[model samples]
Target: MNSIEVEHLTKKFGDFIAVNDISFQVKEGEIFGFLGANGAGKTTAIKMMSGLLQPTSGTAMVAGYDVITQSKLIKRNIGYMSQRFSLYNDLTVFENMQLFGTIYKIPRRELKDRIMDSLARLDMTKQANLLVNSIPLGWKQKLAFATAILHKPKIVFLDEPTSGVDPIVRREFWNLIYETASTGVTILVTTHYMDEAEYCHRISIMADGVIRLLGTPEELKKQVGVNTINDVFVEYVKH
Candidate 1:
């Protein structure tokens, strides 16, 4: 089953086209990488699918809800984590999660249990009382991810979720992503990291507001006669 279905989705700013008629589908349990250089329209497309923006002309169904008419429903069924730290710096980790859970309308009693369970999963139960700003950058990123899914949304949008972290941290973060995907939740991530892109089940490379390549990492490597996704990316964005 597909968690996201997009058809001829376009976003324009007056005469400038931000996202051209792009169409794609992300299947349940898949980690889809949306890659592009700066100003490549990846963010524009994501906002539309996430219901933060209205498309100029096209259609999108996210988590079985229409982006145009059912945006509130789509918002209810999705989680989002960004590269920028989105949690409250002054709040304790547990408090931060509690704030988001409350917004998601999770019951007060159940929310505490769920937050504790999630912290235990991350092995960060000891740090629950720590202020979010006091934690390491990597740990904060991981926490942001945990909080995003506390509601167990059907789909998650991770915008540069692994950015600015060390290689070891990135790997650990990917482990979290894999664990979530195993539970049949779809993830659509945008990143500039080529190595991280290789970890995706499939990737779409965008350039000048259009997708120039779409396939599995290995397929793209073979198609481009390259040995790694990094090289394939270099070949596309350099043009």
Candidate 2:
């Protein structure tokens, strides 16, 4: 079964429609990109799929659990890293990991191994004791991602994860994401960066409140007859 499935999903905020009847599916282990301009409803749609917000209509399923009816199960099956990193500035890296470990109810022995593995993967084992505020933004972002998936969730949601990071760091971050996906973890990532969209196996582009296009990177390029996703996005937005 697909890791994520959305059928005519919609979310409204009073008089404003944040996400209109949009639908898409993400297969297991696939890297699916959600792309749009600012205020294009990417975040809102993700929030609904992640079960952080309820949809006004239609349905979504994540990891074999219904989003609206089985929100708790969905929460347990998914990891989320928001645009802000969401790490406590005062907390040490190890301390922050420990806290999330407890919240996720990971066993003590397993948690220790997982923490060690995560630190090693991030190459931050030596700096585990340092406060989050002392680390560079890129490292902090990586740490946040490690924390989010520490519990080995079935899917991970990254909302504009590479927004403010340097290009080198962003490329490194994408490498980590690629490595994670190799382990059968589905990734539903949202970003406004057109370059990053090309890296995904498939992408859905949102405009106003609905998805205007869904296709592979190559297919999207061919459809718009453009060399880059930026030009494709611009072409759509203009019309």
TM-score of each predicted structure versus truth: 0.99, 0.98
Task: Name the TM-score of candidate 1.
Answer: 0.99
Best by TM-score: 1
Error of 2 at 81 (Å): 0.3
* Maximum-lDDT candidate: 1
Looking at candidate 2, the ten consecutive residues that score lowest on lDDT are: 230-239
lDDT of 1 by residue, 6-83 (tens): 999999999999999998999999999999998999888989998999999999999999999999999999999976
Off by over 4 Å in 2: none
| Model 2 residue pairs with clashes | none
Candidate 1 has its poorest 10 consecutive residues by lDDT at 41-50
RMSD of each: 0.7, 0.9
